[model samples]
Target: MATGFYTHPDCVLHEMGEWHPECPARLQAIEDQLIAGRIDGLLERREAPLVAEADILRAHTAAHWDFLSANAPKSGYFAIDGDTVLNSHSLTAARRAAGAAVAATDAVLAGELENAFCSIRPPGHHATPGTAMGFCLLNNIAVAVRHALDVHGLQRVAIVDFDVHHGNGTEAAFAGESRVLMCSIFQHPFYPYSGTENPAPNMVNVPVPARTGGLEVREMIDLTWLPRLEEFKPQMIFISAGFDAHRDDDLGGLALTEADFSWITAQVKAVAQRHAHGRIVSCLEGGYNLSALGRSVVAHLRVLADL
Candidate 1:
């Protein structure tokens, strides 16, 4: 089966500001690169349905929903935090971004697709149960994992986050939940610097310093993430797919290249094939540099699609 691609037009309508790194153009860049690389044709495309309130509540508290709804601006932008902002279309876009994850999960588990990729954003992974930050309003990957665990009756699920910054929100949501194991690598002393300290027993958090390259990432995953994932033997695997660690992206200092993204995807895919019957749901996180983000996503997709 082809890999599933979930996205929506509303995702492009939401904008933080002209100067923000997390712009709607990021999606366009990925789409353009996919076409240019001839990778778009290998996937089954689907429009992301708006997420149900109950699904959103799986990963976030009702208070978080109420806060975003109450603060959503009617015309201009509202600042949720110093870096996160909401415009008139932000709520709708965020909902669709989350919905894409849910849809991808359903499609993957139903055997309609081998695996799926969600290309919607304001890139989630930073928003916690009650707080939205780091250019994220909803924790998309967390919501999907919860749906897989609760709604689909899956007992074991693993989340692999490789964003340049720590996935503090995702970690917080599943901290003590033994059913879920989160293995991740991120730049140390970076934004939202919190992963290097004591982590939950279920978490395999690796803090790679700046200027680290693919060799370090490979070693970390081979030595740390793979073992935890093997022992957990997850029924499904979810990825917090962030490409900001690419050398071209100055948003963070890691010097990874497109080859690294492909390597990581291959590693994750092997884990899925071994333990999860090849079930995978990947959602976009942080990737700021337009060209590199586009190219990196295509490389990752090539591995996922096995093309």
Candidate 2:
């Protein structure tokens, strides 16, 4: 089976501002790198559809949906927080971003693809059940995981978040749930300041200090994450693939490089191959530097595509 690549043109329509780090060009950068590397043939592209309202409700409250619907601006930006903002196209993009994950999940589960990658944005790991934060309107990976478990009848699933920041919202959703095991590592004392106070037994939350490199991160994952995953024997695996930890990204202090991202993907891929029959759905989370983001995504995809 080939690797499915899910994305939408409308995802580029939503923008915070001309100066915001998360911009439309982020997707374009990945496209450019793929074309430049001549690896387009390795992917099976799919357009992201509008996510069902029921799907959104599965991962978030109706009140959260109402909040976004009632407040989405007609002409300008509506600030959800000091940093998170919404415009006319923001909700549209968010829906597509989440839809990409759901679609990829369905495809992977159906055996239409061995694994998949969602390149949509308004990156989601920070959005909670009833709140949107960190430029995220919908929890894309959360929605997809719910779809995999609920609609696809999957009893066990594992989520591996390699973002630079803690996946506080993902933890908030599945902390006490045994059917889902979440393993993640992020810079400590960082944004959101979470995943450290106390974590559930099903959660393997590793908080590394700033400037931590790939070797330490890998060792930490080997010690903490792999054992839980092996015991869980998940039917499917989900990845919150964030490359902001790359040394070139100014948004984070971690010292990961493209090689680090590749290593992480390989590790996760190995686990999926062992227990999941190679079922994996990866969604984009963060990575500000365009060059680094593009290269890192390609590196990650190369492993997934085995190209």
**TM-score of each model, in listed order:** 0.99, 0.99
* Residue-by-residue lDDT tens digits, candidate 1, 207-255: 9999999888898889999888989999999999999999889899999
Candidate 2 local distance difference test against the native: 0.93
The TM-score measured for candidate 2 stands at 0.99
TM-score of 1: 0.99
Clashing pairs in 2: none
lDDT of 2 by residue, 17-40 (tens): 897998999999999999887887
Provide C-alpha RMSD values for all models, in order.
Answer: 0.7, 0.7
Which stretch of 10 consecutive residues in model 1 shows the poorest summed lDDT?
189-198
